[model samples]
Target: MARTYSLNTEAAKEANNGGKRINETGKYSGKIIAAFYEKNQKGTESVNIMFVSESGQECGPLNLYTHNSSGEELAGYKMLNALMACAKVQGLTWQDTPIDLYDYDEQKVVTKTKECAVELQGKRIGLVLQQEEYQKNNGDIGQRMVIAAPFEADTELMAVEILSRISQPQALGNYMAFIAKNPVRRLKNSQASQPAPRQAENPDPYDDDIPF
Candidate 1:
């Protein structure tokens, strides 16, 4: 399939790689628009999920790696269950996906399947959030609003003790304190301060005067 450019649209355009929404610490609600099974180099299997809120705030491409390479049974499995329960996401439909292929003729990489890995898109999710601030590669601080809390799309239940154990909201007192003590490191830029070498000039590359 070809691509279409939405040059003149009032849509929520995605921020280029390191972009984030400036939000506050509170309850957030959204739906899971993307989810698919993924595996790591160590053979750990996971489902990567991403969310978008009503006001266009995004949370993740967060990974829930339950199938561990180290084979620790029941570790991190409960979190995955919470997501399914809240979203009412039942009946997983997994398929044989092709992850290693390139189409040179189309000049693109393609995976042909019904939603490819597993169709878990458009499922609702809720979170208790905090706009955790951190510095960036270029010495500028940027806000990253990570979504997905596994709470119902209506409540964070932040105060209840039992709620904390079950729901797993982002910024409970314990987690927030830990974060304050050890702030998240800035995003690493692979091409950090790399030289941008200019291409060799064609002398008059933009000269439109064709003589012939």
Candidate 2:
């Protein structure tokens, strides 16, 4: 017996693949859409931020070693200071108050005060995108983009006026063509990337330990 099925070509051609697209390495102004903390082997905290470029393309899973949960004075202290300073550029403010009763006068009644942490989402920032290349254990060349934390005087800052300029959508047409050509692969990839009910691990994990 032969089984027949109907094919809806137009519908099938709109599927999405599981491969997360990375932005081309370059300086750009972007908005942080998501952020979270991931711990390393030594229990150090790294801030992971997902950015969407002005072009409206998702570009990052940018990792910055900005804090130490252990608080033992690790290497990232200076970087953390810079990050805190940069918070001001994003319209964030810091509030400080004396911790001792002796230091506080009648005007200040509280013993302690605290500033809000950087709220990255919906904030725009300028970044220097750098590309690093390494040979994998399998002898494949692996390339990745990273934020070149700019602290030097020579670091170029994108002008404030231009930061608000609109960017054309970068991938819409090509993406449509990609789905048209690889519809079945896209469908399979998407399905495989979703987590199953009892599975704890990611179904389609990338090779690198660091989330791009």
The alpha-carbon root-mean-square deviation between model 1 and the true structure, to one decimal in Å, is: 19.9
**Candidate 1: residue 54 lDDT (0-100):** 66
Measured over all alpha carbons after superposition, the RMSD of each candidate to the real structure, in angstroms, is 19.9, 19.2
The lDDT values for all models are 0.50, 0.42
* TM-score of model 2 vs. true structure: 0.42
Taking the tens digit of each residue's C-alpha lDDT, what string does model 1 give over 1-212?
A: 89987673334344432234425455557776566677679888777666667667666555567777776743335556555645544446776554422366787756533233354577667754544345767987776543223456654433222222345543344544543443332244532222222212122211243111
- What is the C-alpha lDDT profile of model 2 across 39-154, one tens digit per residue? 78877766555665565555555666755766655434433334332332333333332222213356643443322234644556655455545456797756666654322112
Candidate 1, clashing residue pairs? 59-146, 59-147
The lDDT of model 1 is 0.50
Clashes of 1: 2
**Which TM-score value belongs to model 1?**
0.48
The pairs that clash in candidate 2 are: none
